[model samples]
Target chain A: MPEAVRSALAIAGKDLRLEFRTRTGLLSAFVFAVLTLLVFNFSRDQSLISTTDLAPSALWITVAFGAVVAMNRAFIIEKEQGAIDALLLAPVPRGAIYWGKFLANLAFVGLVEALTLPLFVLFFNVPLGPALPGVVLTLVLATIGFVAVGTILSAMVVRTRFAELMLPVLILPFMVPPLIGAVQVTARLLGGRPLTEVLGWLRLLGTYDVVFVTLCTLAFSAVVDE
Target chain B: MPPEAPLLEARGITRAFGAQRALRGVDLRLGPGEAVAVAGPNGAGKTTLLRILAGLMRPTTGEVRLADGRTPRDPAARRRVGLLSHQSFLYDDLTARENLHFTGRLYGLGDLAARASRALEEAGLAARADDPVRQLSRGMLQRVAIARALLHEPDILLLDEPFTGLDVPSAARLRGFLAAQRAAGRGLVIVTHHLAEAWGFATHVGVLARGQWAQLGPRPASLEEFLAGYQELVDA
Candidate 1:
């Protein structure tokens, strides 16, 4: 319903505003992602690292690492300020909160991936063309999947004794499937493989996004209810 | 519905953490506009009981029912109940008004802006509606939590340590708020160690030791006798 959407957007908007006003997390994610990409590019020769070779792997890897960094800070301030309880008590569907967080994190991660993509292209001379849309779509799916797992895990670990150390330890293994699918599809496309040849990976990625998102929605109440 | 049906009925509620028992076969009730104060030392399962009623935690052995015959058989039914805890469950990132609107929406209230505005006004936070909750003092934050509970006009309001961190003024205002809510035909339950504060507003009082209810009913006319009874329960 519109009411739920409004509430979800309100929670999401508040989060986005907080993140924007204090760009510390997003900036760190961007810088770390760019640094990783740079390191990857320089490690190989220009001929070996071209769009045909490194474009797919580099883009998805940068995205994966950037999202992981950003996810750690997702609930950092909320837990510190004791604001999460208020959000949990609101009447909005628990699922909408999931959407709000997923979308907000999506926007931030996507921005980093967007910014990092061009740099990757420029550095590796990967021809972006029509393939760009497919890549962005893949990025969105992967980001949603990653942020879904991240938001729930972040909420759980944020208040624990050692949050920063514990979150990645719990979340990394679960994130592997999405990251692999993202990198594989990107690589196959950059290698000039036909969409049909790589469509199965995209299907797997899409399925992961849908299934995990639904699971997160159903299970998020347990996370905040604690 | 039986005229004698307790306004709120808790039956066979049991919760445990590891090998320790927080609550075991606890049963209690509150009539309309009545108050129940739960007194117990730490680790007595007082909080665990409140959380279970608020749907934050599930009972290991029992169920909560509306004495008015409106049982909380499902999620929708449970949403109508209110709970205020020591945690001051306010999102510090949101303004008082924003927080109200958000909670109101969760309760499926339309015209959230108007309800939020009215609740803020009622709580005397209307003037500071736009200020983030973190900027407010502990007293003001408590007021915001109270406003959120009353925003939906729930039939049952649960207060757990409502005055623990409050200043004198905030505590007085909250007592007034609870009395007014009782006047509104809502059942009020206060869980606390401050028997004096509980006596000030609650028409009914209960002593909970370990996991059992030792004494629960109308406040004895003689304050001295009730205090003696309370002390006896604590010591025994």
Candidate 2:
């Protein structure tokens, strides 16, 4: 791997290993995603719109909500354990820290997405075909977007009181455009509809990723500084 | 004599948060190996001034110049100008070694383990090097915090209440460490409201008041003179 990517993965890998060791944040997020999808199955009308019509929406809504939950606890280990200051004193670019965080968050939320994807097909019975790869692609791209904003916001809200409540309240509204965009593209992909139909939302999701990743990287030095 | 290159210098640095003025037109200089203690009452701009000097917060009105005659470039400068603040500035989840290695990576230090191991020793945390900071006692954690701060081998040291909550032994050891850093030709600035130890080891001292500096100079010609000046400020 390239040096930059190696560093990025190490950041992600370390967080994953820590989470695995502590079973602090990631486990709950995974269970929460699975349970959320189960609730969606019992509550929603499966017949009105082909579950496929809403499959993308259901999956991403699950992912988005789970992202908030996962992101809330993302820095808990660092903040509570006293590791944050250690990370800050290091000579790594603040952007590297942000990416490290983003990747960790991306892995966490991606695990939730991965778990729910099968259950998404099982419970909602969304039709799957060659579009399986497309759905996976959409999930990864949207994970990057989810993590970019969530990572920056998590760093801010974690230090404040009412962290758990504050994160979702702040994140869910901002999550809409991309959440809708992810769902729309997924629906089109699963339905085997023309890419042209979903391209608008696809572009919207792409744009959200670019703008947020850039803004967060630039503003991150303030978040880490004392 | 000739201004001595002011190891770290700030010209007209000003920062205001909303309506409250944190710092206003503050200019200060530190020469090589000078340890300046910044003293002020609560609400004084001591913390704000240190933040600006550390390059964490950009000054609204002035510039911070390094002794090398250049703009404060990046984290490396901030790393070199170390501050021991109320905050530990560490990663709580990672063990001491993990924490140090992370920082070592940032400074591009080759042989991360060597740097980290040496720092752990310097902080007197070698025995507890593998323990998570959360599990360490306050004093041990303080030592770890010091090790983390010194991992990069900074040229200037800034301490903001470094002694807060430390036991006498820990503080004594810390005092020795700070003294050694000063002896090594690094500029050190410490800000504290506590008078007893604040004024003890420092060579040069500065008093900050109401968003401005009131006085700054060498150690009192006599210890009694330092107390009288500090007491006057406290009573004022």
Candidate 3:
């Protein structure tokens, strides 16, 4: 019931309500992700490339791009309505605003990923039965990394002329580290490699998440203050 | 004991964007029950000054402080200031009532429903409270924007060209509402180009030219006198 938490939740609730009313970001991202899975499924010859080998890269790529699409609106909506100024004028700490947007983006990307995971299975014939838990963990960590960077970068680019073009360009470079880490762990999990063997990748993802989330949170006030 | 300090004070505020200076050593002080009108030509930094005063932007030099000595950048101080800029700042997808409720919650106000309903009624948007902001006309949007700004009942209100898009009736209503706020002893700073309108309400008038205050003093006895004085200052 702390004020910060309450404020953050209020922000998240407002964003979620807006998204529910329009479903613009979620629907577009979901469709884009599904199409990505289908293209990957159809382009590859089943005999040459195994589903397990392709699934990790394809899934991670799809999620990353889909996440970018979702994050495109994270700050754009605020900027379009000039609501960012309203938000900045509030008494809440700037970090809470960043976290609120981060959480909302996380949920959005998670939803897209959840809906796409089933289609990924249907198209790739990759059994997620035993590896589900590990895959989920990797997805969560990787998403944290994606959204932390995306949330901050989205705010940075929202004011620019080429906001849509700028978001992916600015965010993709930072996303490389986390995406690589996620794909490797996902490949390992799908291949039945021991958890100990993929520990290093998980650690990398965790470090990326923790470092970027902290750095972005700290940097948000400066970015929006301008 | 010393008399209470002004509700808001800005000392030596200067702002520059790259090679261009927008504000130059501006000092302003507003006390309770005083409404100051700032009039300036285009590119005179009136909006910039208001933004700095609202804590939405940092000054290149000097600082803004509340009566309690908290800097404008302080969250606590921000809670005491309300700003209505040229931008409505309400979500196009959200209803008028929702916008008020959302802003009220951001300020951590209790009894949100009652407060939002009251603001809706005050702004005369009660019937259309559930309609999205994008569906409203410019005048209605301005009214809702006013409601949103006043939802928290801040001690100081900073308005930038609030009458820009309002219809005649809406403008008159806003003028009346702002007068009521002034009567209630809230400090106000309004930036506008409408000399006569500002002269009608402002207890003090300031003329900003080329990022500097060319004239700052009491309101002239008549609109004609104020216009003549303003023309003399600008022409000089």
In terms of lDDT, the best-performing candidate is: 3
TM-score for candidate 1, please give it: 0.88
Question: What docking grade applies to model 1?
Answer: acceptable
Order of candidates by lDDT, top first?
3, 1, 2
Q: Residue pairs in steric clash, candidate 3?
A: none
Candidate 2, A89-114: lDDT as tens digits: 44456788788889888878887778
List model 3 lDDT by residue over A1-226, tens digit each: 9888888888988999899999999999999998898899899998998888889999999999999999999998898768999999999999999989999998899999999899888888887888888999999999999899999999999889999999999988988988888889989888887678888889989988989999999999989996
What is the lDDT for B144 in model 2? 73
The native-contact fraction of candidate 1 is: 0.47
Those runs of model 3 whose alpha carbons end farther than 4 Å from true positions after fitting are B1-4
Q: Which pairs of residues have clashing backbones in candidate 1?
A: A83-B91, A83-B92, A90-B106, A91-B106, A91-B107, A92-B106
Which DockQ-derived CAPRI band holds candidate 2? acceptable
Interface CA RMSD, all predictions: 3.2, 3.6, 0.7
Tens digit per residue, CA lDDT, model 1, B1-236: 65655667889999888788888899877778888877787877888888777666768788887754555534455566788877766666668887777677567777888888888887778889999888998778888887887788887888888887678876887788788878877888889888788777788877777887777778877767877767688668
Which model is ahead, 1 or 2, in terms of TM-score? Answer: 1
Query: With candidate 1 superimposed using the best TM-score fit, by how many Å does residue B177's alpha carbon deviate from the native?
Result: 2.1
Q: Which ranking of candidates, highest TM-score first?
A: 3, 1, 2
Highest DockQ scorer: 3
TM-score of each: 0.88, 0.87, 0.97
